[model samples]
Target chain A: MIENVTLDISGERFQVFYRLRCEAQDVEAFARHICVEQTIEFPAELIGDDDIRRHVMGQVVSLAPLDDHSWRVVISYAVEITGFSLTQTMNVIFGNVSLMPGVRVDRLEFPDSFLSRFKGPRFGLQGLRDLVGEKHQQLYCSALKPMGLSADQLAQQAYQLALGEFHFIKDDHGLADQPFAPFRERVSRCVEQVAKANQQTGGSSRYVVSLNSPAEQIVEDAIWAKEQGVGGLLVPPGIVGFDMMRRLADDDRIGLPILCHPSHLGSYVASPDNGLSFYALFGQLARLAGADVSIYPNFGGRFSFTRDQCLEIVKGCTDPMAILKPIVASPGGGMNFSNVQDMVDAYGKDIMFLIGGALHKGDATVPENCRAFKAQVAALLRR
Target chain B: MIENVTLDISGERFQVFYRLRCEAQDVEAFARHICVEQTIEFPAELIGDDDIRRHVMGQVVSLAPLDDHSWRVVISYAVEITGFSLTQTMNVIFGNVSLMPGVRVDRLEFPDSFLSRFKGPRFGLQGLRDLVGEKHQQLYCSALKPMGLSADQLAQQAYQLALGEFHFIKDDHGLADQPFAPFRERVSRCVEQVAKANQQTGGSSRYVVSLNSPAEQIVEDAIWAKEQGVGGLLVPPGIVGFDMMRRLADDDRIGLPILCHPSHLGSYVASPDNGLSFYALFGQLARLAGADVSIYPNFGGRFSFTRDQCLEIVKGCTDPMAILKPIVASPGGGMNFSNVQDMVDAYGKDIMFLIGGALHKGDATVPENCRAFKAQVAALLRR
Candidate 1:
């Protein structure tokens, strides 16, 4: 009888242990129910009472309680599942429990056989730092936005921001295949402008175009962006399925780091007790789904998320799991140059400081404004 | 200049009319900025200053403010369009606004060119009532279980509940494709069992299987279920795209009323002033997305949705919009026979009262329990 469940909680991984203290007569039945209920939502009658009794799968190896009341329990069942994907494993663990009210999931554990094939993060902390040429400093990030712009106009903004030496510039999540600016034309122009800027500044500022095309267009867009020399992509995992992210990350030809945008995803993690923890959703899940950078609304922004929530998100991104990925926490919305020092102090050097609108609002010319914003970011890191 | 920006604000269509309140000096610039910002996200320089100036074309017809803060402003402009589809139209209105902070959407007025093709709901309120053979009575609903059930076991449960004559029996959202109980087998068994029970009792106990399959699989699943004589389907619009629901609703061959599940969708309407309003999301959008029934967590249930929020959802469903559809608001989670009277008084006849878990715990067997539950609902509706 296995009784423990192990889950990778957002901030840190913990080996959670549990002991199911049930009536002696119901102990074995309870153990079997947990084993099946954790992974699949199949009813007890479906598997037959006799078969459940035979399983006798009930021993707790570890139990960890999350900030939420739910405890992550790791239990080993005698049943063998072969050739199933990680998603299948996840479905097996908590598919049924998700439906039951008050049944909180703490963590999940995989045997070495399943874990070996599970690619955590392709280009992690050091890998991303090496790609961006930022070794122990916070990266500066911005978004090219206000959608109705033409391809040429979007490119110019990208060029200005890149030349100004913003480490990362991504398309606003709203910038999809709109008639005003088709995706290909927009990506081509933006990438070209960024390349020219890189040539002039000797800075490795990367433009991450939003890849919000349908499933069929996802691979094509990624491949096309790589061909056009775009550095990365901004993907909304909530809109495009999680599997799409995995496919993009696995594509060696499309080697650009994937920045996850949490646009329509707030519903899943918005509740304090229900849904998922912000860190688990944006950090662990995003990382596991293969995000090199995860962008969320900064605290004190228009969004309702608090400062502590933002910190927890950062912790989830940087904290150690089975694999350590330096997930650049790009928090945007109402961020400004004045707040750079405070952001640095709050998130430390291992973060991507994202600011938008404010950089373009001042009377300063584009290049001057860009340079000023970059300077402020650099100054904050020095502090 | 087009004055009206048509929007599908979570399924509630609003034709926004707003006057260009910018100064004469800034009107053209503002118009161009709005276009570029809403459509392309291009900077001013990238577009030739003259081209940008020329693109600021608008002819104001009339402007009026609604009872809401929103104003109805009409303008006409030669807007460059990339594609024209239901999906694209939705994108054109709300896509860019999603990025903008504090930009309250006004109203939407659509030209016949766009509006003519949209068939709001095929079998809305009256159609659903006719099918169920109840003109002015609340429907009783319940979910099957936590999952892990075998086909036979699920069928047995369905038989027991259907024999009891529950108006609607649905698959739990968590019951997706799994090895433990495959979707097709489970659907086939449950449908057959329910049909047998219906034959015996001559009751309208419809079985709504969860149809949260991928987009491609959606049509096939619906068609197959229809062929097998299943009554309806359960769709999670949040998990599956909203467009998919529209597609399913548009299909005549697979004509079945859809029950919209708020599975991974709470985040969008969870915050008070952040995402779409709850009524807007669960009621209007779900109905627009072609749901005959919409399910939300009842207040005092396992979820945190408030009583006011629940009522708003009901109002959104039954409200007389451009086209009135009878959207049956089905609230579940921890509801029991004891609360049937309160549920009826709160939601009224145009509702689907959902209760689960509690039925199985009663001393009365499945059939007797279901009969008593129905009697309770019937007694409440008589008032």
Candidate 2:
């Protein structure tokens, strides 16, 4: 059936190059286990058969020993196998083998044939900048926090933030459709307040509400957000499937800039040699999955990401690849006003600094705190 | 705004008790970090506010030091916060903290009020038994594999296995609507073949096709599968969202026995001191999402699952809980016709033994191998 199975390394098939840490194990046996577990879970004899080996089994392109105990193996699969869907592509890459210990997905290589399947980001870096009308300086984004606040209270906070120097105001990932503030009511009020603030300040400040709900409702709410003319939409691809983000990006009816939040997704990258690289998980994959702005925790912040990890995330967002455009790397979670200069130096221009609690701190008002954070970043641009 | 926030530990709120391995660290500070990361990503001073603390903050119910390093911490969240949705529930439990190291989620305790939102397993153990018409014996399931085979060839294999003894015939998790054999054609042919084989052998073999596809296509294909009289439907909740399983389970119109496959979800359970427990991920969560049968890798097999982990999965599947019915605990991956007795001894009855490669091995034909597998399990019952 696989009459024209290509063995050429530079072929059209999108490849997932996995960097597995095979500690003192039989490299060949481990490779076979990965190949069989991922693709054809059949007998050895059947897999040994040339036809099955060529067509179905994953092609082991290269295997190099990293140390006495680890091996850096590169295995490539035909794009036809994955059907170019993000969900199936992930299954082919790490579905069954995820059960195995010490195997990490360090690199992912996708040909244009595969990349063409996804819309990537609708309003990518340039488009988002164009929308905000801030072409020169780095962006400042913040989330409405202390989630017990009612819809009106949250909206008032959003208004205050918008009145300040914040370009993007978002609902905290925890602020789902609860009794205190339902989805429709919360989204409507917040968007309206930001709009009012935008009109008063004569600045483009967008309020992106979280659209993470049930599947059908996800689409419905996204459409409703578009209808309401909300500046952008926030979706947690970690909680919802990554493919759902692609679907949202591809949907012509719901044309809105998407902000992808990393909630319930840290397990994939927390381990050193088990799950995924910071660049791959938060950067490349998030961009490919149609995240206009990818929000993760800052390095000096309360979260456990290292400075190098943060830099890699930035590179992954802006790295030149195929036709895919670069996305905004928005880092937050325990970020404060004091660290803005250091963060600006670390991430440079084209970054979105997401400071939450710090913007609400100090003797000054929330807007004043926001102004100070913005001024600090703008001063760095002048330097 | 938070009118009636409860401080009582014995309230209707759901609690997730995590056994974090914080080595020689400040236990209270670490606990507050988790609480803040999971809920309000704000300042400690803001969190210390009584109104915000009582209403929004995740309460540290108990904290006890373990050994020189690790600590056992119990945290509780208001059920109203999650809105009783599975997506929101997971977010509240581990969303941001999953990014942090050494924070393993050991226990999850949900009240009946929270659990009542989900319809756990429609058919369950007894319903599956009634469907197969085998009341007392253990179920034998097989995957039609070596994925490159055409639809006709795979269907022929399914027919052979059905004629011999397989109670449940499923597509391997890898087999999506690939170019070799598209989903609709393969599913239609396999169902017809199994139905024909069932008629010939006077057996009640059920062909459960994999419905792992795009979101919209998933619902459409489920409807199509029902129209084609498919016996059961298997969904990979890992690839799609867990809420998709809930959606499929809640759909009364389709009403096919749903089998939840644990593909692309291993990262959550691979780490010892992080992510989720085996019982919670595979057992409790799967059942709550409406998995009539939950499939996971068996211990003493090709996979890395330990014996204790496998047992916990069984306990999770069959544990006593509200009105939710107990589902079948299917331990699979690299199982064989030889290990039937050992598995029976370990899991006893009410288990589904899924053997793939081994069934296709030995001098016996595929059907003969299936027959031998069934006989081996049946002989255990004779004891």
lDDT of each residue in A1-383, candidate 2, tens digit only = 22222222223555666767766557878886787778887665654445557656787878888887777888878777775677788888888888888788877888776787777888889998899989978888889877677788889999999999588999998888877788889988998999898999899999888877986578888888888878787888878888788788878888888899998788888676677788888888888888899999889787789899998988888887587789999988878767877788898879888877777766888888888877878888788
Interface RMSD of each: 7.0, 2.9
Candidate 1 CAPRI-style tier:
incorrect
Each candidate: what lDDT? 0.63, 0.82
lDDT of 1 by residue, A1-383 (tens): 11122221111111212233334455444445556544333333333444333332224444544333344445654222211333333333333333333333333344444344556567766677888798877777888865556778778889989878888888876677766678889988998899899999998989898877654356788899899888888877666655457667867888878888775565455444334566767776677678888888787764556788788788778776654455777787668767767677778777777777777765786668877876776786666
| Highest lDDT model number | 2
Off by over 4 Å in 2: A1-11, A47-50, B1-11, B47-51
Model 2 lDDT tens row, B28-80: 88987787778766665654545457756788889987767788899988787
- What's the lDDT for candidate 1? 0.63
How would you encode candidate 1's per-residue C-alpha lDDT over B83-172 as one tens digit per residue? 334344444444433433322323345444444445656677678778877677777777776444566676788898888888778876
